[model samples]
Target: MRIRPVGRHALLLDCDNPGQVEAWRAELWRRRDDGELTAAEIVPAAATVLLDGVPDPATTAARIAGWTPGPTATTAAVRHVEVPVAYDGEDLPAVARHWGVDVPEVVRRLADTTFRVAFCGFAPGFAYLTGLPERWAVPRLPSPRPRVPAGSVALAGPYAGIYPTASPGGWLLVGRTGLTLFDVHADPPATLTPGTRVRLATA
Candidate 1:
């Protein structure tokens, strides 16, 4: 891991990959909870973790140097959220054709697999989930829709995500969920967060 100063308030931990990033993030959380570290926010991104609002960047950097990642995969102790989806999307048939499977099989595969929220981006409460079988990876739509309705369950590349609010997107829609992923007035706002496990189920 490489530590780099980000301005005066934050330090970025550059990890080898997302898995390492998660491992380091978890370690940081443990340190934060144990009063070994002080920060206003600790965020894990694609390949780095940001320690924001740090009081002493140099001390924190030294502490990180002595820290070792606990595990490569985010621990299963993370909370699991079930999302009910209606497997009826414009791209349902297309996805099935791509996988050489029937629509029901696609739904079954999605429901049976457990996923983890690797990160969040593109929109508020929009989480990029990992653990989809590599063979299930699919390409994004050639032309992004002007507007994709909220609650749309979509897949692009190797990730699955839900549209928290109505907006433009390119991920191919495979289903729809009724859950409120993001609520501005709600405490903590986003329902899906990094390291949170997810299970999809048919409505």
Candidate 2:
């Protein structure tokens, strides 16, 4: 675990990969559970985990290095969530052109795969999922749109995601999902957390 300073209040854990992120997330949480370490918050991300508390860098680093997990270790339990989406977006045709196929083929290829929530960012509960069809490597829009409406499903640069809430974003928009991802009333907020598998299909 490589800890780096982010201004003064936050520290970043450079895990470097999704598997590493899961391992560190599991390890840190285990350590916290065993009282081997303490922190205010531990949020895992794509290839990195974050510790947001003004802890002494040296002491925190030492503690992290010393703690070890038991022989039988496992990544946190992940849930498989099926999210339904409608293939209707402003950028659908562009995505189709990029795929060098008809619009229906774009939808077919996307729906055929099950992706994992690599991390959540950009906006609240907006998951940056990975494992897109390798053939479909996309680039972001030349210029981002002013305001992508809430629930606008977008795809860009090997990532797929829903807008979660109406917010300015850069991921290409490909489809819209009827499912609601973030709600203050919901427990822990985002329905799909990192490490969780997501299966998307037509609504």
Candidate 3:
């Protein structure tokens, strides 16, 4: 793990892997809730967590530097969300070929796996989920679609994602859902915030 100062009041912890980031983020959030750490935001990414709006960067950095990398004892308050999906995407056959399985097997595998939100990027409410085994990793499309419809359940590399809005994307579309992933008028705009667990159910 490497700690780097982002600015006057923020520290970016570069973790070795996504597991480290997830574990550390849980620990940090636990500390903050227990009145141990002070920060305005604990944002997680692919392999890093950004501790933003910190009161004392120097002290926090030093303190974090001494910490060992391992699973934290923190009990995360995880949220589980079920997404109803129609496994009828244009790239469904391609994904099955890549996995060396039939179309139903692909759907069954996705339905069985409980994915977690690793991060949110690309567009508003677009979450990058991780949970699929590394061996089942899929490749991005050779060319991006001119416009990917909203709620398109897609996969790329080891991450599963849902397109929040109509836009150009490169991820392999395996399914689609009617659930609204993002809503500006809602309390929390994005439904799949980082750390939230998601399950894809056949619609």
How badly does each model clash, as a count of residue pairs?
0, 3, 0
What is the Cα-based TM-score of model 1? 0.94
Ranked candidates, highest TM-score first: 1, 3, 2
> Which regions of candidate 3 deviate over 4 angstroms?
67-76
Q: Scored by CA lDDT, what does every candidate get?
A: 0.89, 0.78, 0.91
Error of 2 at 199 (Å): 1.3
**Models sorted by lDDT, best on top:** 3, 1, 2
By summed lDDT, the worst window of 10 consecutive residues in model 2 runs over 68-77
Give me the candidate number with maximum lDDT.
3
Candidate 2 residue 37 Cα shift, in angstroms, is: 3.5
The sequence of per-residue lDDT tens digits that candidate 1 reaches over residues 21-113 is 878888898889889899999988888899999988999899889988776444456788999999898998888999999989988998898
lDDT of 2 by residue, 91-155 (tens): 88899899899999889888888888877887789888887866788889778888888888788
Question: What is residue 102's positional error in candidate 2, in angstroms?
Answer: 2.8
Q: What is candidate 3's CA lDDT for residue 141?
A: 87
TM-score of each model, in listed order:
0.94, 0.81, 0.93
